[model samples]
Target: MKIDLSFKIAVLLVPIILFDTLAYAGIIPEKKRIIFKGDEQQQVLLIANTNDYPILMQTWIDNGNTQNVPSATVSPFIITPPMSSLAAGEIKGLRIIYNKQKTLPNDKESAFWINLYEVPPTSKENKLVDNVTVAMNTQIKLFYRPTPLANKPEEKTLVTQLSCYGKAHNLEITVSCKNPTPYYISLSNIELNLNNHTYHNETQLDMMVPPFSDNSYRINVDSTNVPQQVNVEYSFVDDKGDVHGVKSTIRID
Candidate 1:
């Protein structure tokens, strides 16, 4: 990642909210997530400046750490034009080239993050205070697909392959799911029905299960009567960020 202090950019891990006013980031990526094939030499990401004013942009690749700065992170991929200035309503492509020095897992898919920093232009009136502008940082998931997995079924199809089971302990019921596919599965809107009762919450079960991994969530129930079986309903986010639903039944273990 290249840093240009001349722009007087101040990077923050979280969005800056000044009193009642919110600082909106002007840059938008064309895709919600990126899939990079090992056979390809490079992957390109197109971003646009939606605001009426020009903004400075900085990009970097990290190992899924939200607190990692550009200089502290290391990865096999390099983004071209790490730092640049975009005119208002201008669209530009960012080239991501793999260095090939780092050996990633061959059988399973690897994951990384693409971070973009948008620095708005400093107001002339604020320049008297040293011309510092707050920058908004955004990150998206990037999956590296080796050549071998290219022939397999799409990730969306693998949603049906997930196996789940339920177990009750004390006043809580635990639901565990196993993802056998090589691709990661991002789940949301998880709802479990047991004994004619539905257990669902806004912040309870949203998670991403890694390849060949298991994820479990516990839901508290008031009744001591635990059901022997459960119906699991969930939704997964695709590469395009569209949500799709899935239903399955699991027995208590």
Candidate 2:
């Protein structure tokens, strides 16, 4: 459904706050992230409203900034029907159209964020009364894959090219992964077992290592001695956001 101009203006005026607490969202994205191929001019995203009440969803593409609203954000893509309403148990599709005016890097993948602002129906009777109306803003990763990279190997095949190692400094140990491929690696449940002791990474559980880059996580160790053999167990997400677990022996230096 089309949102009126007045309501659309109000949504833009509302302060867009990024909350750390994740609440149940009435509007749910069908996929974890969107992979936009350079060959495709437009892509469609399916969002479903699972709540009993209707909700207004405003979408925009931003360059990794969650604070930027639809009016102020600059992106190469524009979402069709930026603002629309969904009835209860309704499914709607939002089309992302790429503007050829802007130029993005063609060698590697560029990342952006697609924001979904969900606004609930406010009561007219409680308009003048003091009430806390909480609105949820969800952000999903949008990767622009150039046409040339399509012929390259997939993430699962390139996963073997990643090298994991460990380093010891004083009472802490650092675990590092070197990604030599052109695909972004999203890893989770990273664990290092040494001498039957499990060490969890201090970094975020869901870590995305950029293409051709290295990410290191520090873990506290009782001794400064770095073992020669360290068993590393981790899970990496593919392009489709599916997780695959891997176990390998890493060296310590």
Check candidate 2 and list the clashing pairs.
none
* TM-scores for every predicted model: 0.79, 0.80
Per-residue lDDT over 58-147 for candidate 1, one digit per residue giving the tens place of the 0 to 100 score:
999988877788999999999989998999877777999988888788798888888888888887788778665678887778888899
Give the range of the ten consecutive residues with the poorest summed lDDT in model 1: 6-15
State residue 221's C-alpha deviation in candidate 1, in Å.
5.0
> Candidate 2: where are CA atoms >4 Å away?
1-23, 125-130, 203-206, 220-226
Clashes of 1: 0
